[model samples]
Target chain A: MTAVLDRAAPAPTPLRRDRRRWVWGLAAVGLVGWALVASGLFSGPVLNPAGSGQFGRFAAAALRPELDPGFLRVLADSALVTVAYAVLGAGLAVVGGALGALAVARTTWGRRRTGWLVARGVVAVPRGLHEAVWGLLLVNVLGLDPWVGVLAIAIPFAAVTATVFAGILDEVPRAAYTALLAAGAGRTTAALYGLLPLATGRLLSYAFYRLECAVRSAVVLGLIGAGGLGYQLALSFASLRWEQVWTTVYALAALCLLADLGGRTVRHRVAEPRPGAGRDRVLSGAVLAVVALTAWAGWYLALSPATLWSVRAREQLDYVLSAAWPPSTEGPLLREVLGAAVDTVLMSVLAIAFATAGAVALAGVAACPHRAGPARRAVGGVVRAVLLLLRAVPPPVWALVLLFVMLPGILPGALALGVYTLGVLGRLVGEAVEEADRRPRETLLAAGATSAGAWLYGTAPALVGPVLALAAYRWEVAVRDAVLVGLLGAGGIGVVLSAATSSFDWPAVTTVLTAIVALSLCIDLLADRARAALR
Target chain B: MAVGERVAVVGASGAGKSTLLGVLDGTVPPTAGHVEVHGTDPAGLRGRALRRLRARTGTVRQHLDLPGPLRVVHNVNAGRLGSWSAARAAWSLLAPQGTAEVRAALDRVGLADRVHERTDRLSGGQRQRVAVARLLVQRPELVLADEPASALDPALADVVLELLGSLAVAGGGALVAALHDPALALRHCDRVVGLEHGRVVLDAPAASLGVTALEGFYGVSR
Candidate 1:
């Protein structure tokens, strides 16, 4: 009986091998199909209002972007609105996130049943919906004003910020917090004097990062006709005025870059150790000025209760839902919508693949410690700067730029989305590499290996699993971004949804939105699977 | 080779016996006092230089300090890290350098059979012998042990102390070990020094260190 069982087990060896090969083959096919779709090889009917013959003319118009005097004025106004929205939104997010983080952080709030459960639920609900979805909901309730955009961005951003803040707080040494508690300090006092002080440096850095993201989201709020660069881009695209679209996109990109630089400067200044009274006074003065300006801007932007609870708000919300609910799934649109959904998934996969490759290359260089000479350090700094720049510019702006240079196709959209994803994934990968256990690398260094060699042998193996997990997570993020990029007329499910919404085809809009939600959930599931496999 | 070259560590509670041993082994650097081992100033060395200085000294901690996740043979081979190339050191993690050397070291410390076992699975006494095996592999010019036998039984502590003394004598390497028991220090070490409140109270040959000297070190009448 034992001999028979052994023979039977051996018989399944080739069969198991074949099954594994088949799964790999299926994965490869899916990947190749995605690549082809991203490269715009799939043919379909053009949804363009203009004839296909006029494609060249549109392309030409995009090349010489119009910068007339009136155009500059609009650009300035949009830029101001964008900055105000970002600042106000980020301010609210910080306050809300701080409160929420305090509630969730075990060091501050004892892990009681009701409070912990409520705080966790709050964190879970807001972050589950995308910022765009928040924007849509707020626009319905608060009209198309800038305050609606601010609330929309702030709500989701605050939830994400709270989670990250709590994570940072958890890393603070437990001994310090415990000592404060033992000394009869209350939860609030412990948070203020013990945990918060220890975590302030890291929290400030993370806040700046979120500020960068908020600026990008602020631009997207324009898609709902909230009077920003996105609104102007949408108008220009509708009228086939490619030059105006390009100019608006350029202005948006510039604002993003400026915000990126300003955030970096602020982070550096706040992080510096101001030893003397003079330096302390200067820092304190700056903090006061920032607070005053932020308050003034929030009031100016009309983020007050009166604006959010106006009588007309109810009617507008009803109108929006009446136009969007009970999705239409019939007619020739069904096939077209399904095809666009597949295209969106393909774009996400391809973009993630490209970003992963870029991140690995850059992280290898950036993970080197400062001991690698000034030149290497300088190069690493440059790589980090480039990453920040890439991340700072929103995917929509990148889509506009690529759309102008490349032929109007899915390839441009994929490339734009990929570049944006690279910035995010690269930073995460570099951090993981930097934070890995240093002992093995030290061992390698002690044994006469060069710095690079040590990293390759010791750090790379330790970090690869985490890096892959990060990349997979970014893939899910890229899927959402890819849909947004499609709103720039790059041919995906988002383009279909944008067309439907513009035409007031509420049923069609609902169908497309449902598909997007489903697609995103699937991507999230896949990312989770990848992470589990690596673990 | 030289009589005074062999070190003798003695101290009462909180007198920093471990701290002195750490400084000698190039681990806990001294804040005020200068340290020179074999006419080389270790304080000025940084990066690679510090690593090189550390390689010439063998250190055994009171808690074993073995990589608990690793095998005994691999932990022993960590002593050869400074001597091997990076590639060789990494490869030694998989296939250790000269099983014969490891075997001989283990045999010398009476742990020849436990060489393939996990370091955490060993008993307190066996783990101390493994630490001795590492010291045997290092073969440094000086060995600094911080209360190496404090956690072991009296009989096992004696055996470990005797083995350390014999190894130092055989290699002509300087040996400095902290001990709470004056009897063990006198029985195994050539000289004994007693410290009280970070200050030396008694410095004398092992034979001369009697009950009165111990009483002075502990600030008690005996």
Candidate 2:
């Protein structure tokens, strides 16, 4: 019976055979789409050689870790700001997610499926959208209040958290719920007694996951003038202070890693159920204390509810509303916007393809830590660390850094996105390789086949399907990041969007926002279909 | 064969017992034959017709093809996939369909409580039982077993074979299984058709065929 499950399930043979052909066909279409856009990508020389001196300085600065005392103090302070934003942002996401989850609960609307779908969809709107875009949008209405930074992070985080919370709620045992119902208990009492206890642990762990994401997003918010290490980094980047930029980057990296380590620790502790009541109590206390401190810091920023309704804020919002009404479709500007969007799509496609290809080589070593000598394993470790740094620094930061070496254009954006995407794709491909069946590999090894040859014959076939699916998923993400990559330094529709937003060109900004949302949805749908097909 | 007839097709490797079963299951068209199954020509069925015919005739292959990732209940429920509307079937995955009916089917195979458990986590014999449970849920007029117990231990294999036999007889349906071992054919089956090189070499009641008399069916035709 192993043969039936090994190669095929009960799915008919024709469907099985046709699916393989369909995958290849989709891949070909993707390539042709990329080619069409790529062919029209260039007009003039893509890069200027004038920045070679700055590039050299930047290369030299990488050899020296940032250690100046005054600069170190600034980094430390900014680091605190970034963490506070993340903590407060995550706290806000939790509150918002809880409220949103209530709206999404099926029992709330009863048989009104459309209401549930609408609630779920409204929650999903912020997901996959760039936090920088949120920052820009909020800043337009709210000015530079601390709420802009917090809300930008909170909105999307809440949207995703709500969906996950609902999933956890759905999985909670219904026995207590049924019992409560039989006793004529209200939905509120039953949910509180039955669902909350079951869901809190998983939701807390997931909130920790969101915290790590929030930290990264807050850093991205810096590009749109929301204060943090990202703001400082962008400043240092603008003045060609390579060493200072690297120092700020190192601090940001430290903050991200710390958040990740702490989140993992908390999640691990939360997951341990047996013989850990005292420890769980202590951990929960610590979490609450930290949250209180973060809320205090967030409050200390002097943002008041009164400021939200301030005459100036209201006037600015009114001005923006009047200005942005009715998106512009001027013939010349419309063509230019479309061209830039096409460029953005092409760059993202190129980025994913390059990242997937390079990641394969990186994954080969990473998947097998016992690959030959200790020297080779050490090299693999070093490579893995570098890739971690690449992804952890975030794409916009990479774009800013790469701006010195290459001209501001689609090419630089593609390179930046590709480098960042490599880290993600490498991890995915490595996991796929590790999970694949090893019997054929063993047989080949026993027959004196070379390790690489054994992998080629055995592991490659299994890796191909999953890797393709993951690469497509990553491409969707890359496209989202590509928007901000241009806004940061490299040129894309983000540059146009940024300019439009700055001059309060509401119509043009609306046009750009619409284009991005449309593109994002289209790519998301296409990738979803492809991933489903692969499954 | 009559509606309640029980038959066994015995063969060595490369014999066409599986091919014949496939043709009877409406999955494979015969090169040239009457190909009669359940008062209809299975080879001539198409689309909805083919699916409807196959729904009343459950076939278990050597590989015991229950989806490993799904719960035992879902695998069991998949037996009625042919009868379910696409939306109903899809929605059933979110929450199980006909839970009581599925549990009843599982009870017959001695795995009524493992319905919610992932099929992959089960032992090999248990997975085979889950597959049998699927056939039980199907309620097919004909039970076709294609070396279904080839992968099981001897004791477990006997349990599976006996369950298939008893279930078919209890449900008043015919049972036809392809067997590799002639001894198993003699023990569990009432009548045997010994196939060699895609043709029947011997046909008789199990009570009449002795151990020595099964040698011709076991010999390699190649």
Candidate 3:
């Protein structure tokens, strides 16, 4: 084709996809095909109808959870430990994030694009790994120390927090900052006087959001024996005590709800502070509460700095490093890693596609719109709770449970991650719905259009952009979370890594981890490109 | 320009008025000509020296580049950022310092009651007055204002210009403001410098110029 369109040629149809989008669309279709083939769905029977009886028992146990007073007390204690881990982990992440943001921020690098890129690259290594992976590695060194749970969450979350904080800081209008610099403020002081205030609301809101995620990550870490609710769940799950597993799951769900509610309250207050101020009282109270909770969490965990430098810790570290060095480049190991990496990508793509579809379907009912009828409100509340429960029960738990009825395959694993992600994507999509401008819909309705017609013309059009963007963003997260689900022999690099670790093949473990990080980085870049294209 | 003399720089859009102010404030370096602010070339200076020079040269940009989410008091206190220690500057955001002075400055701008309000919540004219209040707290020896009263009505604009003029006179400093209105320029300033296409078209004592003549430099015919 010519670089310039012929003057005589008619314009292309508006509905037609541009070349870039067509290319992306084709690539997407190709990837889906690859995922399906790799899933081996057509090659074999992937059903285990007999296991449904067992799955049924697990489902029924959700209704009559193990409510023995003794078990309840144990759950209560474990729940506190989970809370402590979440609080301390999230709190430390925020602090580390602040420092990391400064290190990586464009404002800090200014014209030094290379330095900024380098900092971002360094951060991606930690950010690419899941909390569970960190927990696994830390377990090798720390061996059941409370620090493992905290650090696992803190490391990856801090990297994420840094990325987000830097974005927030970067997005602040630079006029105020430049004006401060013109007025002779030092770089740090200028940023403080200018950038910080503008970014504070978003930063605080994100911190609260991270706390919510930390609560979930803490539970996930517990699954790998970090000692919390997930540990109890795992213990019961191993013994096939479905009732006790459901009880632990419910307890975990309640903790998640509390964290989500508290975080949402703070985020709202921060977003719209009360008029006048010595400082916002609600915000001050929340900050004070977090500080108190963090202190208590630290004390309760009995975290000692000495543990990090202890002889045994250093020995384990040295041993692991020596064993893991010169990561296995053997032909068989490399080939397996390559295959598993593709499987991980396919699993994530399927999971996100499933989640996006489900989220879009449920988002309308999930969003609690003002002026909605009582019946609508009740459905919305129930949908919201179900979404919460879906997300709260860690992905590994979902993976194991799904394995029972779906047979050992990628489909079950993808569905498990898909189900959990839907919980998150659904709420986000619902919020997008709630925040959408209602004027168009109302006007359409006022014009005597049917409700479905109004929704189609007004709501759906606006929602497509935000929902797609959220789904694309979550695609990156699903890939990382896929590692968690994959650990349970669900057909991903996680499975390979788990085997290597179990066999004490440290070199092979390193190779698998490298593959996971590489896959994640590729997905990260692809997701970014997709977002820009979509935008 | 003599100390305490209020000068108004007038020009069409993109006529280098802001560029000139930028050079004087040391934020923009002149490619050809030398610029000496308070007897030091800001471009030649470095580190502490440059900051000290800038601390004494307060600028009120046309956009009134105050952080919108910040409290009015903190925006006003940002003027003190040049001279205050970083620690003090950071602390002042949480628990404002020198509120008495800030209040007095706000009182002059008729925004005393809005000291605790967010800067963005104010109207355009009010935010402009807040910028003036910032300069008041800064107490710089040299004031540079770019269309500082553009958002205000005639009465408030006069009040704002008068405050700026008096501020310069009180501190034995010079006020060099870029004004869009010739009448205000004549009333508030001693010297008026007019430019077109980055070249100075007219430089005369305010007494030597008339509104109609200044209007010509603005390319206006009525």
Candidate 4:
């Protein structure tokens, strides 16, 4: 019952003591920095502009969204384009990811020396950058068009998908692969016959999930004038038309919800029993529909073969590179950029903490089926709904609304990023908790411990590794969001990037872009180490 | 004083016997029912008391429950989790100490030189032995095993049960094991308790547990 009694036996060796101290020191520094930022001692700007009449105008415009047939048509066109972009991007991503996965998979590369290490490094670098950043770079090189968005989503999504696919390939019963090899089957044949069948269901499920995510990224790409719902939303915001913004927001939300529902349904059906021994008709039908619709929509968006060779495309590409490379080193601008970078890091840390804590609490509730009564179930349902709502509302929109309510600083950005990450990490945490072996928790429970107590002792240790992994992943995501939030004037590197872009200061833009990439790489490295440690 | 203890657990297929082991280890809480160990309610035990109880309890399950990535020696030393600090457990994973004790436990279980090898590379029987070594390190006064020999060949099962019996006797630990093989239980245990429908149907000394008794317990007369 006493704390001292519960204190784990002392460290058996001096080496462990040093490692413990180092870990604690790193955590302490992060905590202290977060505390200082949260305390509001370094307030940067007045983000919320009152008496601007922007809200009223936005409200008036949104109220009559249903009346604007022209805008509705625009929305419909944008939605179709969004779907097309996601499908194309996902298709490319799947192909690229599969190839990349083979290159990285231990089964394929474990036998080779140099190729294996190079493949691992390549996988690491691409996965380190966010989809949005990838989009930014691609749009600059390819031009502000659908291809830009498609390539942007494809690159990072492929990297992540490849990593996941490699894991699945590794998990394939080695027995099957080995047997095939023993029978004189080639690596490709073994992979096709042995690994493919086992991994098909999982790979499809992951691809479907990525399709949902790509839809969201496509909307973000639209913010950069790539022509989608996000672009429309951005235009509405810039013009201070709240009503149009609401209408566009609602459309995007509906699209996300539909995708989420459809993906879930497909995933469930794929996992369930087959009616007959025939091919899955439902899967084939859905894939065909998606492909046909994407192709048609791409044609309608004027993303034709000729578009690729257009002078406008070339100019846009030139504009993007001119702004993104060779960043400026001007004195005052450099100070602002540095300050923003610090703020962005602070925002990411705080948001990740909030998400981790929230996820831990909710995951426990969601994991227990029996304890969740009607009321508890209802509350859980509400929490899940809130998470869906937050996820559907892009961080930019969340920031837009929060900027109206709170003073412009890291707080609003942090809150928005935290809400977004909560949706992600909470779902992951709940799944992790549910999937963990229940024997330990049941043991404590049978011994007369309460549910919470059982979870604290039994379930917590097993989940610590997974939960830490989820948190580290979320930290990577939050860093990317931190930059986007900076665009809302919540003083971060994003704000500097936005300002430079607005002023046509290509040198400054290049410098800020480099810093952002460097920061992202650093966070990625830390996350990789943390994941390894937990594993 | 040792109060007579009666425990019955019943569930359909996949009701989770392995989960029950976790309850004994202070890992999983029971949905309903009272479980007291040694007349002390482990339910009320918090941080220290719970840790102490967990440290002092020996548990084995159907599958090899050793941390597969770790060396066999470290897996065995996990039994000493109660006695060792968290730091020690982690360090021991990297470079295990108390080599002689670990070697002795392994040798007793028929795996003398595989101590430094990774547990994942071991066969099912070898892995089970490593787990037995862990139970030896725990040195608990009571043992709870969940279908411990279900995955093993009959010969290996006999070896595992023999090791469990000797370890329990040496530590003066009361052993509670769920066994599918009635003959093995009779051979290895001093007492046998039969559970069929989540309630104990028969409880008797090992010598008294015959085929008729088991058939009656299972509702099938052979």
- Best model per DockQ: 4
Q: Is candidate 2 or candidate 3 better by DockQ?
A: 2
TM-score, candidate 2, is 0.67
> What are the per-residue Cα lDDT tens digits for candidate 1 across B1-222?
253345568877678787777667665567887888756787786767666666667777766656554567877776666666668866766566777788778776667777677676788778888878877887766777778787777766777777677677676667888887767777778777676676776677777777556646655322
Candidate 3 residue-wise lDDT, B76-160, digit = tens: 7767766676567656655779988988788777777788876667999999988899889988888899899899988788888
lDDT of 2 by residue, A445-500 (tens): 32223345445433564566688789889988888899988776577778888888
Better of 3 and 4 by DockQ: 4
TM-score for all predictions?
0.62, 0.67, 0.68, 0.69
| TM-score comparison, 2 vs 3, better candidate | 3
Report the poorest 10 consecutive residues by lDDT, candidate 4 chain B. Answer: B1-10
DockQ of each: 0.05, 0.02, 0.01, 0.07
The segments of candidate 1 whose C-alpha lies over 4 angstroms from its true place after superposition are A1-79, A91-126, A133-144, A158-212, A220-291, A298-313, A329-361, A364-373, A399-415, A425-476, A489-493, A518-535, B1-222
Candidate 2 C-alpha lDDT tens digits along B1-222: 655667889878878888888777655567886777668886665566756666677777666655455667777776766567657766776677898888777766567657777677799888878878877777778888888787777766777788788767776788899987777788888899988788888889899998767866576652
Poorest stretch of ten by lDDT in candidate 1 chain A: A8-17
Error of 1 at B145 (Å): 5.4
Steric clashes per prediction: 1, 1, 0, 32
User: Model 4, which residues run further than 4 Å from truth?
Assistant: A1-32, A38-77, A96-144, A158-199, A235-250, A267-276, A315-336, A366-368, B1-222
Per candidate, chain B TM-score? 0.90, 0.91, 0.97, 0.84
Highest TM-score: give the candidate number: 4
Tens digits of per-residue lDDT for model 1, A430-453: 878777776555543433344554
